[model samples]
Target: MDRRESGKTPRQLVPVVLTGAMGKYGGELWDAAERDGRIKPGRGPNFTKRVLPDLAPLLRKDALDQGIPRSAVDRSDRPTRGVLIPPEEGGPFPERLGPCGWSSEDPGEFQWDIVTRGRAHWLLARDAVATGWLAAAMHGLPHWADSEPVVFFSTHTRRSARSRFGAKFRTPPADLVTVRPDPLFPELRSVDAATAAVQCLSSVMRGKKTW
Candidate 1:
């Protein structure tokens, strides 16, 4: 019989809840769990397969209304070569451009640029719901109520902050940890965010050091 069932104090087990499980960052967290032999197949219907398709149209429309051009929408059936605007001479242009084509040139413009990308929108919408589901599941798990679970978010933004999923982390019980690699280490930064998060979590779990 389980110790808890026999009136013994339940062993404390820290459960790691990864928000962007299928995304680049979440994938790293999953891998980290695998290395620690803590990986388990997620329960319930696949969120991406069963839920995302139905929501994609609504999300796509929202993106369009948010200034994202239809052309930027990612389509599974075709390739999307995104637009790239060259930097103006002597203008304040960022040295590097992100996947969504935004740079450090203007914060306001960069914010819009991010929402306009279909890929970005898709990822955001999916993550929003996935985290919600994770939160609910964690609440239902045994002994979870007694300890706070670590939630790793792949990314966030001002807009996402207002989203239901984002709001969850912003508020209570969930210990939200944004997994980012140290920028000073170029090699580490080059790796996926998920991998970096895993490394950091591993370090913390081992009580070796704080991230």
Candidate 2:
């Protein structure tokens, strides 16, 4: 429910939409992503990497070692601008790579990496703040469930921004959302411990159980 599945445009993958890079195809896609840090060593990139709201550029930059395939795009099927196409999906994942090799994804954390957190940076407004369960995860809390939807609170995003990208967004009193650099990834941020705790508790008490 939190994913960006709305709008009349086709959000699913289509050929030549992104001028895809010559992706790894079969297992190579994951391999390439891992090699480029688009994904983690033993974990996939969610392939959408909504883990941090600002990770889109970092993730996209980590990829594209190869060039995207060229093809004639049909005018009737041209993708709408500003659409939320998941990364990699728009790439050259052609059947050619399908026969390259036999490989299997480690099912263990695949969903957590790929689905639990979508491409948050693209879906969220640039100034979004990680809060609630996500803040706990940012703080390195253990036993936090990945099944829980990532949550955020932002004052800068438009009111039209919906709860998508595997996360929920809210506008709160500006001072209530104190932020600090994420201890794990200093480049990103999370609500401070107290703020995270309060927000997490507030969600729980309010029965906001969409996740």
Candidate 3:
């Protein structure tokens, strides 16, 4: 069994958590864990980027110009936010186009941009939640295949995108546990579960150094 999973093993991994531009605690945790040998960091920021059909030519030309292929234009220029269309009662896609187009409404069809190694930013955090890696990589939450227990930290004062995303998507059971408000000083918390998270992080570091 992995060190974190086995009670015999000490907590080694100490992954940090972050939300895009609002907060960056995850990076702080990573730096601290790296400096101290007892703690190890795991997981990096994961994010999603919207993909949409480009309409620059559509704006420039009132009518189709030279019959340019819809797929030939650059999609990267599309807006990042705003609804392109309204949801239909029983249609695959809405009938109208908004700023971002159809990709803005459907979560499943929304293209996800993920990064394996990078700064733990808000975009990454959102993507991690969207992709099912936020808790495990950031807060020592359990993996779907693991039997080890998990603990969750949340902003109790208010609902957050992460919490909402998990609820909307029905976050995996193993990834959910006791969730609380964002700690004023998360590093100062003392709990058995917290200790386990630290030990698990340590184990994660030990394995990383060898590789």
Candidate 4:
């Protein structure tokens, strides 16, 4: 049934969604939006921060549970710290990054069946699933089967480039656009990079003839 016919207003129509908002790419987009007056206080796509924990331990346990030989599972890359840390402890630098930790009460929910080295890919997959669910719930729909365009700003990492997690959605939006920063500007700070990226995206969104 149509929402209007059902006499219920949709929770809120999010015209734009910025995923990985805390990461380099997403952070850039967010900062740009703020600077350009596009985003106001409490007005924008739902901000979802991607938080990762050390996945080495969880992956090792998962491998063992899957009957993999102990020698086969590499423990050399095991993380020494959890994702969450005190702000005073030089918060969340590149060295402290890890996989998104599981918070489900059920132990079985924390399975690491995907045996790939792409921790970022795994995290992105989880994020896609979560956003899909959120869209469905907020719109009172069964799934993300609509044609609304979603603009995603991601880094130029190989894992993110090769990730097929977007397709995992039951009905992925066809107009989804992924924006990445120019490789030439590798030394650009987050805010600077974001400013450029957001400008490009804004042009595209405005139907301008530039990339």
Candidate 5:
């Protein structure tokens, strides 16, 4: 039963990582960075004149004062790996909900409770799953891999028994890929997603990295 001695070795890392959809996704700025080679091959640090100073001291001492051009920084040499969900696309289905729905005469007039609760449950789970992924990264053994994969669960239309719980509430989904049904996005409510995403990356860096 000693498989380790039988000419097999344990894998050093897993390829997939989960992050919050709301906070990590790329936006106009990231897009510009990608276009300008600031993030060179998606491996180097972001280089804005403003941000460059914050990162300059991070360079190893031997490399410091070496007269090396910023462009000469080897991008493919970064130890950690990452992906983003972008501000526009992240959240409880950002594309689906609009301001018009919530501003009507009756907030509950359209049986939107079911949708809202579904969105909350999915987002909460997403936060939990992202935290676990980050915890794994904290071990310092993971080598980030690059890939963007999206999976979705079956679409279901169902009514919640506790729609009138006073505040938002709903049944949680059994799967991580399920979509959130709600459209309302509150800045304060989104903090959990942001926090989990930060944990995912910060844990891996032992708190050295801040998102």
Candidate 6:
């Protein structure tokens, strides 16, 4: 009865990751290989700086261009992981300038939300899955705002990540995932509303912010 001891393992869930469109737009940022992970037979960090290389620099200048003192600008290095959503702190999501630790209590300089930023992130990360309220909104539900933390459901090892403000990742059974049905990106998938509701409830039970 013990599957682990019986030499049996659970089946793997493989989500389809599309990058053709993004590759065309992004211009060969990174590659996804089987064993090596990143494209181009690379395994090291400096694998491919050319992929979305300009994003960080753009965000870095977001504050400095506004006359925020050079001392105030956060010159932190971009995160090494594949962040689905840019962290509000030290993230490269453009329009979100920071003192490297911007928050509700001490938001410095400026932070703007662009509705299409998710699309850009998806372009950069071909495996992202919008989840929770963000998924509901993507599935045509109304009343969702850009101010909320963007949620993405991922079971992929390298694709999943948790962050302070930007894209938040949730891993669940994902029994019934579905596409968000966008004209431009119909391939974008998500854990259905029921799964997302359960996830949100679980977050609340675990003492995490419900929203």
Which candidate number would show the highest TM-score if scored against the true structure? 2
lDDT (10s digit) by residue, model 1, range 90-209: 323211211212111221212222112222333333343212222222122211111122222334432333432122222212444332121211111112334334544565588754
- RMSD of candidate 4 to the truth, in angstroms, is 16.6
Candidate 1 similarity to native, TM-score: 0.18
For model 4, the local distance difference test gives: 0.27
lDDT of 2 by residue, 1-211 (tens): 1222223333332222223443423264545533443332233323232122222322222223323222212111211123222233343333322211111221122223222142344233546666776665454332233446555666765443253333556776656645553322344456787776776677668986333
Per-candidate RMSD vs. true structure?
Answer: 20.3, 11.1, 19.6, 16.6, 22.8, 19.8
Q: What's the lDDT for all of these models? A: 0.26, 0.39, 0.25, 0.27, 0.25, 0.38
> What shift in Å separates residue 7 of candidate 5 from its native position after superposition?
46
Residue pairs clashing in model 2 are: 20-68, 21-68, 46-113, 46-114, 50-118, 50-120
Please give the clash total of every predicted structure, in order. Answer: 1, 6, 20, 3, 5, 3
lDDT of prediction 6: 0.38
Candidate 3 least-lDDT 10 residues: 111-120
The Cα error of candidate 6 at residue 184, in Å, is 2.4
TM-score, cand. 4: 0.20
Candidate 5, lDDT over the whole model: 0.25
Q: Ranking under TM-score, best-scoring first? A: 2, 6, 4, 1, 3, 5
Ten consecutive residues with minimal summed lDDT in candidate 6?
101-110
**What TM-score, to 2 decimals, does candidate 6 have?**
0.39
- Lowest-sum lDDT 10-residue window in model 5: 48-57
Q: Using alpha carbons, what is the TM-score of model 5? A: 0.15
Error of 2 at 64 (Å): 2.2
Residue lDDT tens for model 6, 1-211: 0000122222111222223322222122222211222111224342121121122222445445656456534433222223222223343321111111111111111122212344445554557787665554443332222345666656665433355345555564636566554444556666676765676566568876434
Q: Write the per-residue lDDT of candidate 3 for residues 1-211, one digit (tens) a residue.
A: 1111112212122212222452322244333333432122345431121112112212212222545334432221211221111111232321221121211122211121111111112222332221222233223332321221122232333233342222222233344434311121123221234543554566567773121
Least accurate stretch of 10 residues (summed lDDT) in model 1? 48-57
Off by over 4 Å in 4: 1-50, 56-107, 110-171, 177-211
lDDT of 5 by residue, 132-167 (tens): 222122111112201101111222433323433222
